[model samples]
Target: MFQFLKRDPVKKLRKAYDAKLEEAMHAQRNGDIRGYAMLTSEAEALWQQIEQLEKK
Candidate 1:
């Protein structure tokens, strides 16, 4: 009965993933290779989670 009240985890993860990618872009532009790599890895992990959730 409260389904509407529940937030979708995948959506939240996707938002985080987008933010991470944006940050990664900025890092790359600023020549922060290390930060860019870390953010890209985190975004990739979030994408995996989103894919897994979508499969279900």
Candidate 2:
């Protein structure tokens, strides 16, 4: 009955994903290609996790 009190994993992952993407954008704009790529990859991994959770 307290389901509403439980935090949603997907939502948390999505928030992290968005933050990663934003950080990646800043990295790219700052001419840090390597950092941007790394951040993008991390964001992709988070996306995959979100997808898996959604599938469940």
All candidates: TM-score: 0.92, 0.97
How far residue 51's Cα lies from its native spot in candidate 1, in Å, is 0.5
What is candidate 1's local distance difference test score? 0.97
The TM-score that candidate 2 achieves is 0.97
| Lowest lDDT 10-residue stretch of candidate 2 | 6-15
Q: Candidate 1 — which pairs collide?
A: none
Leading candidate by TM-score? 2
lDDT of 1 by residue, 1-56 (tens): 99999999999998999999999999999999999999999999999999999999
Candidate 1 Cα errors over 4 Å, as ranges: none
lDDT of 2 by residue, 1-56 (tens): 99999999999999999999999999999999999999999999999999999999
Q: Relative to the true structure, how large is the alpha-carbon lDDT of every model?
A: 0.97, 0.99
